[model samples]
Target: MSQNLAEPVAHDGCLLSDLAAALGVASDTADVRVTSVTSATDMAVPGSLFVALPGARTHGAAHAAAAAERGAVAALTDEAGAERTRAAGLPTVVHPAPREVLGRAAAFVYGTEPGDPRLIAVTGTNGKTTTTYLLHALFEALGVRDGLSGTVERRVGEHAVETRLSGRLTTPEADYLHGLVARMREERVEAASLEVSAQAITHHRVDGLLFDVAVFTNLTQDHLDDYGTLDNYFAAKLPLFTPERSRRGVTLIDDEWGRRLAAEAAVPMTTVSTDPGADADWHLATREVGLDRTEFDLTARDGRSLSSAVNQPGWFVALDTALSIVALTEIGYDLDRIDAALAGRGGLEARLPGRLDPVNPGGEGPRIYVDYGHTPASFRTVLTTLRGFTKGRLFMVFGADGDRDATKRPDMARSAALADVVVVTDYNPRFEDPAAIRATLVRTLEDEFPGLEHYEIPDSAEGIDKAVSLAEEGDIIFVGGHGHRQDVEVRGRLIPYSVKDAARAALAKHGWSTR
Candidate 1:
């Protein structure tokens, strides 16, 4: 398998005629020889085909001259882009919808290999990053090198991709994705996992890739700012289960959306469930759960069991483990091998950067936890889990992200009301007023759960300070909304910020020294 990916399995590059014909362009525009396809003009290689797509603010064709100057052989675009490219004195292949075929054209350029790494696509409202992180670690545990693509970072093999970097979007553009996969093939990776966002699916980011298994964690309220409603957001994720998107699918039937997806899936599917009596193909029965360890047994329909223990709570870790197990098993992994590789080390849950990660501030201070749970469902589950383990009053510091789904802010506040104390604050309030955002959340606390004690702060540092100031030795200070984020985008400036630093500072201010 490694040897197969070590060399190209198809032609070096596609003929311009074949590309134009496949894209339904006129045969007259097929005389040029193309060596590659690119979306960014600055990345145009000699003899490469530049794709100029229309954007909300500006057309990509505005940079056609720069791409031509950088040795782009030819270009493809819509009528508007073609007009701009013609003005730039560049030969252009016109298409009505250039993004629809962008991935296919890129695949032709890079030459998709037969033994290319098996790609697994993961999608849901939450747990996407955690699931991909687990799958990446699972591949390592199975002794196969793999690639990881997600919101936090992108890796070709074991190395993080530094060329395009991250944070442009959850998933990169289609051409760049294909290029990254081709690089992974060159590195001879055996498997890869990707976090597919609803926006990525709606924008045709993974257009021409064939996934071995598509895993869905669960669908809930999110991205309503982009999709307008929960149903539309779910519809955006539904396309990933089609035959065009994935070969087979594994989904959690913990929610109605997941059950409906299995029924309406266009490709073959297997169901994984946390409910033992749910008639799922893979059912998880909990045996033990601790603050940092959870033991569960995955029972198949045939009475065979895969007993395992994950180093996390059962509420968040059980379904994720069951889904990944089902996906790997369905993709032809040996059951015995899977059990041996994973069960040997407390299961394969990767220590994700920011999912309920605790910040330790040396002295006998309150145990502080920092997490990235922003949605209503996520807030409820994470709060309930933390609340269950607390001996002292559980306090929370959280903020609603500006320029995101504003409707969930009230729900987040209402959920945080479950805690003994709540501190409302700002997290990356892009153009929106931080005070106004906090006011909205504080208003909800006032109207719904006014009995709980609360405080309001303007930014992350102040929020952490407030939480730490109110905490005793045995209390828990929960910081929510932003976790593992190094910078805050406030009014268009990237200000360096860290919750760990603020927590430590608060400890020092309270006469608690480092141990």
Candidate 2:
């Protein structure tokens, strides 16, 4: 919670003339010094500027007293919030849209301008973590030390800073985002990569920053609860690729959506794919997929083919590898640099968790994988992929998150029906009734495949234990939903539990050898 030394507070504020120009505030009489910047009233430090924004339930101006008491020197607000902020003897920065300008205001205070660094943004429903890490690896190979922000971790060069960030809600608010980037600048990071969430674009979390290159992995049917429609969700994400200033784009044409996106992109565009007939700028032909390593032939637009090996397990990793190649090439790196870096590039730890991973010792009956596949598309994709490798029955243990897009619950059930045995369970019920969610999923699965063996075990831990008991030799048990999440939000509080850890515990209890 301490103020960063690299971004010391400007108690006297930045030069009033400079601030006005940067903020596009044309008024000459508005001269003020800002000590700090904050969005939450409770965290408002003395001499800090409080950003009062309209929230889902209440306006931030309603907490003006708390902010003022905590040392807020001034407040930025719209007309409705101006009177409240002004009454507290706090200087007011009145504007029609204060929330939209907070990131720029914070960047102005922090002395970091747009496009000052090589900012690369990767957006998609999946593969963001792998793509971000892949870009980080490419940067390392080229001696380009960089900062990275994603679901798994945030790092500035080799130093992994613990981030209070998680899940598909990838991008943080602009204030924290710019501040993090400013810290990366202070850390002497030449480049930085971050996952731009669809919500981030909708909420303007990345408004002030311009990406040097934007990557689109693909889009699918997810986050319908927020956007109301898949088209609206995709539209929210399209702007990142079509930035007015920064237009260099690298898209993975593995999916139909990626193919469609490439056609509409205005920036210097490069297409990458693992599929044949890509006609893409970068193509990867999968040569082999062993348990421990995957080899591929990467051919660039210039007709140079680079034979590479990625030390990762998924059959679908080719899609990720192709995107990584395109990302590196767009950043002005050559094939030799890409090959040398990836030669030593290790697997992204903890991303695939127990399922795709074979870290367990031999004679463990069947391998169980714990993943975060909830949507029908992701569920089907994971199940179908696992089905390809399973010589025996495939037992699936999964359930939809509560109060989310309930529309996908039936589709998830249908996908699970494809498995030899389906064990449905809970995953972060939030406030919605867990039993209701389970019943809905179970009923749908039963209706779709009446003859399919299915069980309803609401407690996820119990379901894991049961799955391990039912696994036979060559059977692959997939414990999907809640991958890398340390806790499940039940009601309003977080219960410490992880699907991967729980799966491991189940294996140990069932007399399986875990190295």
TM-score of each: 0.93, 0.90
Query: In order, what lDDT does every prediction score?
Result: 0.80, 0.74
lDDT of 2 at 151: 69
What are the per-residue Cα lDDT tens digits for candidate 2 across 1-515?
A: 22332243322446434554676764235456765667766556656777889877888888887888988877777888878887886777776788888877877766666555678898988777767776776676667888888766677777866443333357777766766777777677888888888888888888778788888877877889999887788788878777653558888787778877788766777888776676888877888775566777878778877777666655566667667666666777777766765665543222333335442536567877666556676677677877877889999888888768887788889878878999999988999999999999888977778888989998898998898888876888887777767888888788899776777788888888655
**Which pairs clash in model 2?**
13-33, 13-34, 46-71, 355-369
Tens digits of per-residue lDDT, candidate 1, 353-426, equal 77887777355878887877678888788888888778898998888888889988888898899899999888
Q: How close is candidate 2 to the true structure, as a TM-score?
A: 0.90
Q: In model 2, how large is the Cα lDDT of residue 351?
A: 35
Candidate 1's TM-score: 0.93
Clash counts for all predictions: 0, 4
List CA RMSD, all candidates: 3.3, 3.2
